[model samples]
Target: MYKLSPFTYTFAGRSKAKKIFLDSTLIFERNDTVAIIGPSGGGKSTFLKILKGIIPEYSSGKLEGEVLFNGHPLSGVYFQENLQKILYLFQNPFSQLIYPGTEEEFLFSMENFNFTREQMDREKEKFEKLFNLKNIWGKKTSELSNGECQKLVLASMLAIGPDVLLLDEPTAFLDPTARKEFYQYLDVIRKDRLLIIVDHHVDEIRPLINKVIFVDHDGHITPGFFTKNNFVVEDISLPKPKTAEEVNVTVSDLSFSYHKDRELLKEANATFKSGEVVAVRGRNGEGKSTFFKLLSGILKPKKGQILLEKNGKTYKNDKIFPHVGFVFQNPEAHFFFDTIEEELKQSFRFLSKEHTVLKDDLLSRFFHDIDLKKSPFLLSEGEKRRLSILMTVFLEKSLILYDEPTFGQDQKSIEEIIVLIRELKKLGLIQVFISHDDYLIEKIADRVLVLEAGRLYEVPRA
Candidate 1:
């Protein structure tokens, strides 16, 4: 059986990431379908990167200990060549996708793996139907949404026939039905490959995993906590606020025609309250993220405006960001920090606590826990996800908007997020969540707002 032993990794020294977060005492062996779960700053992703031999090799970092492949210590080995059998599927499928290449170019990656005209047609018919990807096969990869792109990536990975597949929050953006379908496919996927999934939707995933490795904010990996037969269901208390009757968000006669297409938001009008958490859901190309952008001032509304009501004052467009903090699904996309600590500092600026006044103990604990001194960009997908959330939460804005916070979390980490959200809501921070997690809605969202064909509608409580 394959194995990894006494593994340790740290990022390039940066004052920002002085933390020595991960100290994994346990070893990972074959036949162990380990699910690493933990808080946002926890070292879940870092652990996976080290195992994949990306750390200190493809990446520049300080690494200690050896990762044994069948009792043979192969630490800092030729990671890419050695681990060809292990595929590290990125969190965002689009990032891994070569944008400039055509679909045919992408499909036939290996020069030798060619398709005879007939075989190509047959393969197309099967995969297109299987993945619902018929329409965009000839189009550019940039044209696809997060969900559609993910299905394509999955199709490609399955084709490679890897021995182990490491996925990061693979279903964060998919609808509940699509999310279910993806996991069901993974559980029965033809390969005997040991599956290491770092996901956030635990309710849907709990049944499939073999064992769980629970990690804390301190980056401690404790394996074999929960297994298939040892599943324990816990009732989580989340901070779901009472819905207010007054209109908090008003979209008045919002109409937009993008690139000569029909109106995206055709005179869409709606109202939201401070305590309400609305989820925008629809098929890809339906303007989910677009609606968020309109509200956040990245894209000005073509016709109508998203009016935020704060202390009885109606603020429009750019005026609302200060009142409401938005946590993008890819927080790293906007982060220009040289180190994690700098990013933390920037986030802390929004806090009521003075910069010098912020607790050093908490900072110390955070750095030590998350290993923040390391190169933040070099972190694994899951680690990046957590760090982004931690930065947003630290901002302590009146309103917090999360595109998809739980996308790349394992079952345990998902639960921890639920707990944290509940606690934050108890503090009366306005939360606007755009997510597909039914479990998250049940726990944290007091009201659900669904977007259909770029139109926004609210699902009232029964």
Candidate 2:
């Protein structure tokens, strides 16, 4: 059995260090299937770090607690020695990946543990079949989509056969079908191992979890059942599509590929009109994010043209960057400045004082509990995502591309994003986003574009 005695953790350095866990105690037994659920920025990820022996060791923090592994006190040395036994499935899959190729990542732990060739082969084959990773085999980790990356890392962890598995938002990037398959796979293999998952998609994972741990905003963690009233979500209206002929984006005969054998996009053509919110949908590794990057001028297409037109003037390639605002899927990669205040100042520099005040008010709504003086990197994933969105909106660009804008958001935060998108649409900006969230697509997208097998198809709706 693994147990965490009563403990408190305070983030270090700041004059007002934030307390993440206040005298929280939790226990886990073999084969215990537990789900950790809470609002955004409620210390779920932090708690997982503590369990993995990362807090106060790699990260500076004031921690007072006893974490035991099988009745023995867990120390850095002990944790290092037993790395294969206690595995952590990270929230950002890219953060944990070091190898260039997926196959190398799969064999890394096994090689370290000195597994026999036959044993490694057997375990790899089993996990590959379970994860449906044949298509992405031998591919570079950078080439895979976020969902594909998640699957690769997860399959690698399963190959190790850990006694305890810690997953943080394991399905945040996967499509509906892949998400179902992933949970089913977990349910099948969860007999002897202890599974602790931190996710916001409660309904989808409910059947797989026997116990639920709720972490509240007040730094309290306790056993609880799934409840909708845990968050106060405000009702928000969807964006109203507007008519604007002078502002539009057109992609003509576009073709892109990362490798000669693998064709990501081929002769894809589409148009997004001003004030229309478009959602890009596809299976994992289908290059939906690559399409967004092409449109945003972050990547050059191998063939064809992308034209962003506003007021009868056209911008192409690098020229489009000035008018395009992009919220990357990895929110941390989008941040450059140290403090949130410094980051926001970039957006504030161009706006009038009145507009700046309005933007400040919006930021306060989304980040009420945060201190602007703190680093944006210190914010939770959800908080970082929200900050990226607000900064993008403050830019007041002609076109915006959101790559999974609602990735780590909770119900309340998702509703708030809808409100913000609606406001942007009212300003007649052209918005294109890639998301696996059906509800967000249904609520916000004026048109849905499906990318599959290197072709783009438009779904006509009434």
Best by lDDT: 2
Q: How large is the C-alpha RMSD of every model relative to the true structure?
A: 5.5, 2.6
lDDT of 1 by residue, 1-462 (tens): 345444455555444442333344455544456576665556666666666666656666676666654555434455544554667777767777755443653465332245466755565566677666765566567655677778777766665556777776677667767777777777776246677877755666777777787766655566645433222334433333354223366667776655554567777776666555665656655667677767766677778777877656778876776766677767577478877778777877776533235335334422335555556776656566666776777776667777777776555556656666766666556677777766677777777777786577877743
Superposed model 2: Cα runs more than 4 Å off: 22-25, 229-246, 352-354, 460-462
Model 1 residue 458 CA deviation (Å) reads: 2.0
Tens digits of per-residue lDDT, candidate 2, 231-327, equal 4555333233354335788899899999898878999999988789999999998999899889999899999889988888999966788888999
Candidate 2 clash figure, as a count: 0
> Against the unseen true structure, what C-alpha lDDT does each candidate score?
0.63, 0.84
Please report, as a residue range, the 10-residue window in candidate 1 with the lowest summed lDDT: 229-238
Give each model a TM-score: 0.75, 0.94
| lDDT of model number 1 | 0.63
Q: What total of clashing residue pairs does each candidate reach?
A: 14, 0
